[model samples]
Target chain A: MMTTPSSITSNELNFLVYRYLQESGFTHAAFALGYEAGINKTSIDGNLIPPGALITFVQKGLHYVELEANLESEKFDGDDDFSFLQPLDLITKDVSELQ
Target chain B: MMTTPSSITSNELNFLVYRYLQESGFTHAAFALGYEAGINKTSIDGNLIPPGALITFVQKGLHYVELEANLESEKFDGDDDFSFLQPLDLITKDVSELQ
Candidate 1:
């Protein structure tokens, strides 16, 4: 069996934390960490994503997946991409509007 | 007070999980999450970091900070960067060799 690497570096760990914050849409937390760690290019498109943006982005993705699943294979375009280039619609709506 | 955002997206949550696993040096777990999420550029410098790496990394970083604190202010150049550009020395050694 292959043995695990005996050491891990701080840079690697910091990078992981950086990526995590960015992914979670914990914009404030991610920025705080990146600033402390002195890492460059830490933003997700240079925008401070709101806390709930991630959940909205995901629900919308699942909606699209379910929609695509209902379509016949022939009707589904294999080359079609479902990438969301912009923030979700929910992000644009106000909290009062959501209520 | 400003109201919090009304929704959080799934993509954001997935990113957070991926980041957590990666940051913790759970290489296998991080890859699994990344694969399921269809995220690209997920690896830390294209290598699978072993478990226990994050702990070691942090310990080493603390060692540096402590060392720096012991040095006199004038002796410690303000412009000096403490960046660790390569994997820590511990990583290069084998587990048995470490003992």
Candidate 2:
């Protein structure tokens, strides 16, 4: 079965969610985490990477690192409603911390 | 005790997070919940409302509703890293749903 993509985008809404995260304060938590992937391994540097992908940081940016060789590459194109489950189901393997 | 407010806002980052949620498919989950607050109670309508505030939907919009009368009035404002803690902490009382 296939679901059609519904077009939903707004500059205002985008600003709101980002501002929500900024107020909550979990931006630098990537390196603080220890995953089966790697404690030293990172991919999200305040940039919301796709789930199961390594979220790492650099001096200049917050980037998403995908280790395709070590990871199961599922065909998920673009960020859409399917992403709601990613942080919990796919991204953050360490659930207790997110709680 | 207080932390200084830092200025961090970006059009690109904001769009990224919003697109992430769209891919995950949680936009319409607001009214489907049963909370101690109220099963009929709704505040979030695809739009990310601030924690502890009521998020409601209307015919034309996704809006945030604040009920100061029945809720504890916390003095913190704006969305930040503080928001990363919201979905699991303040907004979602039903831990099982989020977990």
Candidate 3:
């Protein structure tokens, strides 16, 4: 199981999401999210972050969560059974419910 | 409609995919893809890419394709109707079929 980097703060994630929404042409959504998330206060370099970064980070995070769940159940066979599972289910459901 | 950067070569994309497969723990798949795509010969700096770069790039590309399709039909009201469409469907079907 991979450990998440402690360096990645919530603000960075929020900024990324805000940028993604703007890039995808969700101006109203982006503006709302930016306001709620306080993205204007972030000091992140927008140019350094490539487009789709938020989606990529979310996908990787989901995979890590699935991997952790598999390990805890002693079913860590390295098979990617949870690869197709949607992110929302994992986020909303208890970890035990996944197994 | 946004124009995809001409600087993004197919080799760069292949390398990103290769790195993504490796990061996701699909070792055998990564090896096969690397060999087929000649990723070993690519000079891309691995450190520059954050995890999930490939997924991010693909999502952006899919968005662009959807945007272009909407534009051609003169229905480019900035409404994101095709936001939920899967990447495979766009890749396999004709652009006209999407509408």
Candidate 4:
């Protein structure tokens, strides 16, 4: 059972992500645009990101996150990849309710 | 390169879930509570709920979702499990703003 923080609404966390990514003015838009139009074979959606799938983002080196929504890659702390998604927001409170 | 809806803040959607589940008073609290307390072996957190894990919820049939944050579960629409999570809220609009 997933628990939620009382102060931040989960919805707000997702919005923060959206606003941060889009408003950051740092969008890799051309690439992202191409990705959406199917010009790129790659995907960034959670459903598409399988477990253990490895992705390399240029200077970012090899990073791992479950890409296919499944955990296929064996668990190992010494693996060559420096990959992981930020933990999903656990805050349960509505952001507006915060002091 | 994930996409998001423009009108809805993801935060709001999460709140909708909280309101519905909590206010609705349909919590599987005992089971969920046990899972949370580490007094139970099962877990419901996204981190704990992997990509292709098979969970059998009583009378819910054998269901499959990636369980290990990795995609190890074979991809086939004909699988025997009746398991699936609701697609994460894809609403692009804030619920309050909705007409």
Candidate 5:
């Protein structure tokens, strides 16, 4: 019954990815991504987010989307057959397509 | 060049997943998964793992696999066109298959 927050902007997501890359020690990759995404322009404080937050949020979002899809289709019988989603698929695909 | 630790066992992974579910407030799901995975029998100290550790480890592992793929194929020319893998895919698929 967890709901995905509607307020998260693409910029925020980009920042999170940037921070995640940095925290994970992917310095070159982080630099490239941050430069392309203009992460420096964002005002969000990087310190506020703990390490591993991006993946955590994405995982939770995927779960919520799956739950929503199951609920809408009336297929959630507690069978625990939830299909795990790729992070990009969860972000890009429609909920109906996921089901 | 972070190498995936060979020391991590399936029991450790299961424990991490259980902890993740519990930390995310999916109490019933956590209980079910814990029961099925025999999480209580594991000696891993749950308190030592921070929130989001499971997803973080999985994400890092995926990245390492991707990097290894690129290196082995000699296709890594500093271009950042890495394909993101599903968490389950990372866990289930062999490295060669991922590429």
Candidate 6:
């Protein structure tokens, strides 16, 4: 089906499921699916992040917004000349490094 | 902080939250966060998919696996000569077209 048009195959979909299970910390499900589907051949091991990362991700984001609100109030209120050369001072690490 | 070490900036994290809210169909949340963070400058608009897509993704994947099981039992049982030149008969579309 790789040569077909407008169709998605099972392999691609299975990969998504595998990743979902892993990321959600359904380890047994991930393991079973990977084994059955032969998806482990692609070396998807050891990439599982703790399921709590999702909560951390959201809370961290909220904190950032709060900090931004405080900073903008203090720093940008009277500074008509202020322009963001880069939008936010977030992302200290390089994108490649994160990946 | 962009040049700092061991830090993730707010913008990066906010973008993630924005995407999460959008993809999860919390459009109002995504919109609010994007507006506050000035993330809309990057053109993340109109990429929102309904929350149902996640369910559909899993169901479709489960169906694929079921079909594969049926096919393998029928086609591979007696075919010791059988080797998967390609793993599954999935993904009719080119990867490029997907993106």
Question: Whole-model Cα lDDT per candidate?
Answer: 0.39, 0.23, 0.51, 0.24, 0.52, 0.39
Kindly report the docking quality category of candidate 4. incorrect
Q: Please write out the lDDT profile of model 1 over residues B20-57, one tens digit for every residue.
A: 55665556546655665655644222233333333432
The sequence of per-residue lDDT tens digits that candidate 2 reaches over residues A26-49 is 232211212211323332233332
Chain B TM-score (each prediction, in order)? 0.36, 0.20, 0.67, 0.23, 0.63, 0.36
* Shift of residue A81 alpha carbon in model 1, Å: 24
The Cα error of candidate 1 at residue A59, in Å, is: 1.4
Higher-scoring candidate on DockQ, 1 or 4 = 1
lDDT of 2 at B84: 18
Output the number of the lDDT-best candidate. 5
- Candidate 1 — which residues are off by over 4 angstroms? A1-40, A43-48, A73-99, B1-16, B19-99
Q: Which ten residues in a row have the lowest lDDT in candidate 6 chain B?
A: B90-99
What are the per-residue Cα lDDT tens digits for candidate 6 across A43-83? 43333333333333333333333334344644545533422
For DockQ, the strongest prediction is 1
Name the regions of candidate 2 deviating beyond 4 angstroms: A1-99, B1-9, B28-99
DockQ of each: 0.04, 0.03, 0.02, 0.02, 0.02, 0.03
Would candidate 1 be rated incorrect, acceptable, medium or high by CAPRI criteria? incorrect
Model 5: what is its DockQ?
0.02
Query: In candidate 2, what are the lDDT values of residues B1-99, reduced to their tens digit?
Result: 111121112322232333344343433221111221132333223333222111111101110111111122233333222111221121222222222
True-vs-predicted CA distance for residue B51, candidate 6, Å: 18
Interface RMSD of each: 17.0, 17.8, 18.8, 20.8, 17.9, 15.1
| Candidate closer to the true structure by TM-score (higher is better), 4 or 5 | 5
Q: What would the per-residue lDDT of candidate 3 be over residues A1-99, giving only the tens digit for each residue?
A: 222112334455456545655665555545555555567877666666667655554444445444445555556455544433344343334456666
Clashing residue pairs in candidate 5 are none
lDDT, residue B4, candidate 1 = 29
Candidate 6 lDDT, tens digit per residue, B1-99? 112122334544445444544564445444555565577675433333333333333333333333344456456455333222222222222222222
lDDT of 5 by residue, A1-99 (tens): 321122344455556655655665555545555655677888776665557655554444444444445555556355445455543343335567666
